[model samples]
Target: MVVVVGKEEVVVVNFGNSKAVLCRGGLAVPLSSDLKGERADEKGRCDDEAVVGRTINWNACHLPPLSTTSRSLGGEYRKQYIIMEPEVTVMKRTEQSDDFLIIATNSLWNVVGDKTACEVVKRYCVNGESGRLMSSDGSSTAAAASEAATALAVLAMAKGSRHNISIIVVQLK
Candidate 1:
């Protein structure tokens, strides 16, 4: 997650199973949260073999259950196990040449890792393109990032990925 707050814009990105709150003036302002478990699989089931008696290794690195509302919204009946606390990156420019960019994704980390994502962002930055922009208010930065991530996912899909893909992108100026 990268958050950039420049003289002209503010950007934010979310990619983990945790919640991220970007507050203003010391107030708690939630920038992004895994309220819907959108990153989780729709058909993935909890690994029953992972459970030892009644204790389950919920922290296991394995894929979570499709119905598991461990970290999402609209699961009032189930206990909140986790929150979408996104890894945040903030860049605030004090000069007039301030700009913001963000990218996000939900595909397998093995396909397009964070280093690749950062490289993509850097490439976009050096390429000098204007269409790929981040949000100014920092509200849509994640969305912008998601778009970039989606594009990467599509590329990965072309390469071959037998799974669903979702991404968000946001840019500000």
Candidate 2:
């Protein structure tokens, strides 16, 4: 989940391949990790299972069959075979950076990208000012955030997110 601790800081404790990002001026900077199986093995941080960077796709290509158990629970997977801890990123909001933030699951990212998502969200942050931006409606931050979130959800749906999409857009005011 995403937690806004203070005016200029957010702590994102993300898990299960979900992701987070900080956006500024139509660009998105990722703040979370995928925590997939092959990735973990490559870093030698876990059970280095990759044999010359090549392993069977069944249990190697995916997220180590640990994040989810429907495929196989208490099966061949050992504790050392996967990393289940969430990747936490603490972002200290800078007045000059990150106009907003988007926290979403992998479903959305599987179809969209950083810049594209930022652009989609920027559609609602349309204050003009040559992209300097202001709230969507000059009323309240919540309105802007809601509109941006809706826009993102709609766009992700349109882009065909297969899994359930969970998204939150926060205006970094």
Candidate 3:
């Protein structure tokens, strides 16, 4: 989730593996972290809980066999292990330097790095004088964002990502 604070800062909140990335001056900045059971902190949290038959890692290749993500929206039975909490980040926006924001699922991030994803989006969403994506054909920011999202999804697939991919590109500049 995203909230713009007074037109100067953006508040990003995320749970699970989904992530948020901000592009500033052509640089990629991460706004969230992937919450998985294999993570030390996450594993400790589960280990600390006083629950009987708590399984942290299972025989399967996927760590946190109960769920891939340590946090999520719903899982009544798995509530003992999974959480609904989120990580929040507030970043001041640079009107002249900040370019755009990308929110995508783990599928894209599993195969793509933050810098590469930002570069791919920036390549498609070049801004104009109006600070919105514009082309000689009068393409709008929305169209450019869609194109960027599509490009990222395609890249993830080409990189051998088998999971479902979802991406949202928002022009900030």
Using Cα atoms with residue i matched to residue i, what is each candidate's TM-score against the true structure?
0.41, 0.69, 0.84
Tens-digit lDDT track of model 3 for 1-173: 44354478889877776888888888999988877665677766656647423544553113234566767775576676667778788888778888888899888988999999998887775455655654335568788888889989999999988776989988886
Best by lDDT: 3
Residue 112's lDDT within candidate 1 is: 56
Q: Which candidate leads the pack in TM-score?
A: 3
Candidate 1 achieves a global lDDT of 0.40
lDDT per residue for candidate 2 within 86-161, as digits (tens), equals 5678877776666777888777776788788888777666564444334555766677677777777777888876
Which ranking of candidates, highest lDDT first?
A: 3, 2, 1
Error (Å) of candidate 2 at residue 19 is 0.9
Model 2 spans with C-alpha error above 4 angstroms = 38-60, 63-81, 128-139
Backbone clashes for every candidate come to 37, 1, 0
Query: How accurate locally, in lDDT, is each candidate?
Result: 0.40, 0.62, 0.76
By summed lDDT, which 10 consecutive residues of candidate 3 come out lowest? 56-65
Error of 2 at 60 (Å): 9.5
